[model samples]
Every structure is written in structure tokens, then in C-alpha cells.
Target: MAGLAGAPADGVAQYRRVVVWRHGQTSWNAAGRFQGQTDIELDEVGRAQAEASARLLAALSPGRVVASDLTRARDTGEALGRLAGLPVTVDLRLRETYAGRWQGLTFAQIDEQFPEEAAGWATGDVTVVPGGGECRLDVAARVCAAVEEHLRGLPENGLLVLATHGGAARVAIASLLGLPHDRWAVMSGLANCNWSMLEEMGPEKATRGLRWRLAAHNAGSLPEPVTVQEG
Candidate 1:
């Protein structure tokens, strides 16, 4: 809210947008393990990715920066907030889906441990939880709530930036697009430090209802592309 000023009087304002970005590369991301609710820190390359994302976002001049309370996401948000000269707001609801017993485990490990459940998940069954993990629907509900809250508080034509994780980002995007939870597979995975922009039009415009349009993804200003090393 710090940088938000001169917002339009109409509920729908031009230039108002919501930008969503996945946090930079993390140790688990490199290793291809499930992060779930586990609080993992970003590796060295992740730090650099965060910095590069910050540089790209600085050019957009977003008004507010919001992020998941998780360390990896918070750290990424902090970097972008500094670049944009805005404060970072941590929102717990923006966290990734809880992986339950699968936390920190790689896909192969999960297959070895809970083959059936892993197979079910791969097939897009929201209720299949190998180990007490949250169902996909549960994640969708929480993410939708958080996004709704964020949208409600936004000033007309204000710009908001959110830093989050892969699972959460996918859920949020799917919900915004009014797509089925199972269709999450259709939405591409966001690259580390990759950013996406969406615009929500107010109730008076032609699109006058809550609608989100994709603006950008995997976009950054880094001189060199950030390479992701598999763990």
C-alpha cells in the first residue's frame, strides 16, 4: 500500500495489475523433491535468481509486495520489495500444498515408498494422499481465499506483487482462470524466479467481474538465463 497513490475512482482502473512470481531456486527444487510446507532456504543460485527477479520487477514499479510466510518465499519477496522500494507482507495462506509424508522426498523416493499413492497423484486424483498430506481441493480452497482477500484490499488501479511457490502458484492461477483443479497440469510450472502478471478488472468494466488475465511468465531482466541444477 505504500507506493499506491492516484488510483482511479472507477472500480476498474487501467494499469492496475497483480503480478505473481515463484520464488527463486531452492535446495528441494534443485533435487526435484516435494517441498510441501517444509521451510527450505534458497541455495546460492536461488539468491541470484531473486536478485534478478527484483531487477525485472523494479521496472514495473509495483505498489505492494506480498509473499508466503515461508522462508524461501519471504526471502524472495524481500529482494523484490527492496528493489521496488516497498514493504513485504507475509501471508500464511499463500503457502504451498502440504506434502505430508512426502516432504523432502524425491519423485523416485515417493514411488518407492508409496507407489500407489504416487501413481494416483500423477493421474490427477485430488483426494489421493500417500501420507496424511492435504488434498488438492484443500489447497485450492485456501489459495482461493487468500487471493480473494488480496484482491478485496487492493486499491483501484494499484499494482500488487506476490511471491510464492510452485504448488501454490499453480493453484492460485487455476482458481483465477476458473479451471478445474485437475486441469492444473495444463498450467505450466513457473520457473525459479520467473514472474507472471495478471489483471483483475473491477465490477464496472466490460469484463466487469473478477477476471484474471495472464500478463507475463518466466520473464526477467537477467543478463544470463538462470540455470536450474537438478538435485
Candidate 2:
């Protein structure tokens, strides 16, 4: 079960955990091309990465698994679902940023072609939309919403494994923190096949929503709680 603390349907404070798992490496990712809604399947390395990572995540005993509609993300989630014995829920809203013109272009190509716009886009500027793709703000808005929607449906003491893209993972974390556009730039990008954990810190006595904390970032293993002994 996750540490997500909030008033659930039973009118009691329940806790749950969310893991934002980035899809494994893809050929486009290796080539530094912007995938953005592209249906690129995972490369051979990606399949191996997914299997290894999902095996580790199964240790957390996630209650449910959800993934983006894209093949890369779907396959990654399916890996975890198979290991955890959980059904996967697909939601298009969790899709990667719609990087219109930049979909297949490399960062260098984007910079060389649209120098001015590329800088702002790279820095997470809300107004900059590389190749008319979805801006950082738009990506955050939908990704966070989709994740929270699933979070709201889980048992108080459950874990949600979200298989998504790097950009969506970064935006979801920043947006949940209520950071402005400028601050969003400071959130580092998620590496392929890595995952971050957000824990709910709100009190059971409170009547408000859960307060999330960055428990772990870019983690390859599930952190188990342990207590020190008096030697």
C-alpha cells in the first residue's frame, strides 16, 4: 500500500502511494528524437529494461497499474501487471506531450531550426510550444489530472503504478507541487525505465486533500522501511 493520505469515500483518511514509471528506452529516445504521441515500440533494450524494472517494482505490491495508450507505455505497464498479477487500465489522457512538429525531430535539429522557440521550450517555458506541440503547462495539467483521477479511485492503502513517458512524469511531479512555469524548469527530466515516488503527508485529522512529498526520484529499487537497532 502507498502512503497517500486523503479523505476517501468512506469519509476516512486513507493512504496510498503513486509510482511514476517512465517507459523503457526506445530507439527514438536513444536517438534523442521527440516521440510525443508517436507509437514507437520499445527497442530490445527497452523490453529487457521493462522486465527488470517491473520485477523490482513487484516487490512494492502495487494495487493497480495504469499506462498511457502508446505502445511503449502500454507494454511497460503490461510487464508490471503480469508480474504483480494486476490488470492494467489504459488512459489516453496519460499520453505523452503532443509535440506537433517536433515529434520526430532531434533536439539539435529543433535548436538549429527554431532557435528562439527551442530555448524557451527546453527551459519549460509555458508559452513555448516546440513545433506547435502541447506546452509544458498543458502536459502537466492533463497528466496530473489523469493520475489523480486514478488515485481517487483506489483504496486508501494501495499503490498505483503509472507507466508513462519522461516528460509526462516530470510534469506530473511539478504540477502536483503547485510550481509555476518558471519553477517547472528546475524539475529534472526522468530517465528511461526509472521511477519516482510521491507519498501523501497530510494528517488524518485534517479535512483537506493529501499533501504529497517527493519520497524518491529516479529510483531503481523499491525502498523498504527499516528501523535502526541499538547496538
Candidate 3:
């Protein structure tokens, strides 16, 4: 809604809107296991959540639906693609952070076995490589690259949907908005099947060195107009 107001006649043509939707819940998710790049399928609740969320997302009339090649993300994207009649595009770069030795471990297990690493991660240290896996910056770079590639041919005013993982989505949004690494942790992790919205701002309106602005974060509902009184 913030991006929809005060636009020139061709304003809509100047930028594109992106919806970064986190894949629905998986069995690992329910059990608090780290699923980095595990290629897990959606559990029953995950599938149902995807179906429900897809119906809502379809109303936004997305022009493109792209997702991580991992089964959970791919399946989630496919749900929307089916409703929107768009084929889902798979991109491996959109996959979750390769969490190396931490994969398949529960949170408590990590805390017990890798106390230092777990502690750093708990503090939102973007530099922590997660059991020697990809750092947040690494994840951000690849995710942003994938999003940029998909956005290249997007039409003006069109929407692009990304069905991705929670960790990947968090870093992507922070990096795209040009937030400092320390501030990246300010954004909370997304819930299963929830999404964040971003809109590109024309040069005239963009913040210094930033191209995209967050329209919504960790959201399940569609965009709505906001009314505020100025002092």
C-alpha cells in the first residue's frame, strides 16, 4: 500500500513488486529440526497451508512464480502456479542456506554440541557460517542474484512471487533494502507460508543506495491502503 500511492501516470511502469513467500511447514519444521537444503517434502499441514495461501496470493495476479528447487519450496510454488495458471520456475540459488553440519540437528542439539556457534547465531550474527555453512551474506548474494535474474523480463506493474525458505527470505529482504548487516537481524523470521512484499522505488524516490522498499513484512493478508494524518 505504501508503494501504490503518489505515483506519476507511468509510475507503475517504473518498478516491479515482489512477493517473497516462505514455503509451508514441513515435518522437520514441526519438530524444530534444521532443514537446510534437505529437499524435504511438505507435510499434510504444509500442503494445506500452501493451498490456502495460494488462493490468496493468486488474487495478486502474479506474472511469474519462481522457487527453490528443493521439494518443499517447489511444491509451495506449484500450488500458486496452479491457481494463477503460471508455470513454476525452479532456481537452485533460491535454496536455503547450506547449513552444513547443523543440518538435521534440533535446536537443543546444536546448543549442546556447538555452543559457541549456536550462541553467535542466537545473537543474529550474520557472519556465523552455521556449522561452517553459508553465511548470511553468502545467502543474500545468491538469493538476490536469483531474484534479479527472474525480475529482468518482468513487465511493468507486474508481480513476481518467490517461494523460498525462511532464512533465505530474511537475508534477501534485508540485503535488497540495503540494510546494514547488524540491522538485518531486526527482521523476524517469517512464519510458514507467510510472505513479505517489496516494491522497487524509482530513482527519484529511492533511499540512497537502495532500490527496493519493504511494503509489508511477515504478512499473510493482501495489501491495503493506509490512512495517516500528517502534522
Predicted structure with the largest TM-score when compared to the true one: 3
State which candidate, 2 or 3, has the greater TM-score: 3
How many pairs collide in each candidate, listed in order? 2, 5, 0
Q: Write the per-residue lDDT of candidate 1 for residues 8-124, one digit (tens) a residue.
A: 355534855877789988888999998889999999999998997788777767778889999999999999888788899899988988888999899899999998888998877
lDDT of 2 by residue, 1-63 (tens): 222222235554546778999999999999999899999999999999999999988877899
TM-score of each: 0.83, 0.88, 0.92
The lDDT of model 1 is 0.77
**Candidate 2: TM-score?**
0.88
Name the lDDT of candidate 2: 0.84
Descending-TM-score candidate ranking: 3, 2, 1
lDDT winner among the candidates?
Answer: 3
Q: Which ten residues in a row are the worst by lDDT in model 2? A: 1-10
Q: Lowest-scoring 10 consecutive residues by lDDT in candidate 3?
A: 1-10
Q: Candidate 2 — which pairs collide?
A: 2-16, 2-17, 3-16, 4-15, 4-16
Instruction: Tell me the spans in candidate 1 whose CA falls farther than 4 Å from its real position.
Output: 1-15, 201-210, 221-231
Clashing pairs in 3: none
Candidate 1: pairs in clash:
30-231, 31-231
